[model samples]
Target: EADIYQTPRYLVIGTGKKITLECSQTMGHDKMYWYQQDPGMELHLIHYSYGVNSTEKGDLSSESTVSRIRTEHFPLTLESARPSHTSQYLCASTKATQETQYFGPGTRLLVL
Candidate 1:
């Protein structure tokens, strides 16, 4: 499994607070995915990338932005957070030749 990590595993911030959720992998996977989910709900893809400098929005329309500046780093940023943004964010990565995706421990955010 790819070694993926997400920082600030749990975050609680007030509304309008700017926040960034960090995701990284050490396995050198070329493709990465970001997903958002609420409790007991299906996962919603928020963003994804094919490789470095290549990012695409996913099926779910999100107010956050993501960047793949490095192969192992894909950070999602929200300029202004809101209560509606409270959810769990997950990060996953896969190799071009493989169908399996390795996921990181999700980051849970709560905007009060």
Candidate 2:
């Protein structure tokens, strides 16, 4: 089984507060990604990393940032939270040679 995890499954914060959503995996996947989504909607890839020291912004526009300093960890951060940033953030990872992706339980953020 995949050992991916996300902390604080749910969060409620006031506007302008900085927050970090933690994501980690134990399968040693080299490719990690962060996606934004609303309830019952399609996911939009917002950030990704191929490996350590290799990070890139995804197709969608986002106010969040991510870093990949280790092969198994990819954490997303919002410098200043806002009500407009409320949504579910999902993290996924895949091996360098594998097409299948393993996803974490997801973090639900509510900017009040």
Candidate 3:
């Protein structure tokens, strides 16, 4: 089993609502990432963090934001939810020296 955990496996909210997607890992990996994917679509890297106090925006443009405080936890937040924001959010982690990434069960969000 993967060490990562995401809360509220599914969510549905009205437009303009605020939501926060939680992602946590117990593997103690220094590298963590957030990916956005639609059903039957390719996953896109949206954000990443190398270690505590380190973060970088990814190739995709996203309204959501992420933070890496403790090595085991990286949470993403959306200040204002919109219909275009509907997607499955996946969290993954890998060791600094290893390329194998362990993914968390995604959080599926729908905006009305």
TM-score to native of every candidate shown: 0.96, 0.96, 0.96
Residue 20 deviation, candidate 3, in Å?
0.6
**What clash count goes with each model?**
0, 0, 0
| Candidate 3 residue-wise lDDT at 72 | 92
lDDT of 1 by residue, 1-70 (tens): 5699999899999999999999999998999999999976999999999999999999999999999999
Which lDDT tens digits does candidate 3 get at residues 1-112? 7799998799999999989999999988999999999988999999999999999999999989999889999999999999999999999999875679999999999999
C-alpha local distance difference test of each model: 0.95, 0.93, 0.93
Candidate 1, poorest ten consecutive residues by summed lDDT: 94-103
Candidate achieving the largest lDDT: 1
Error of 3 at 109 (Å): 0.3
Cα deviation at 104, candidate 1, in Å, is: 0.4
Residue 9 of candidate 2: its Cα lDDT?
99
Residue 35's lDDT in candidate 1: 96
Worst 10 residues of 3 by lDDT: 94-103
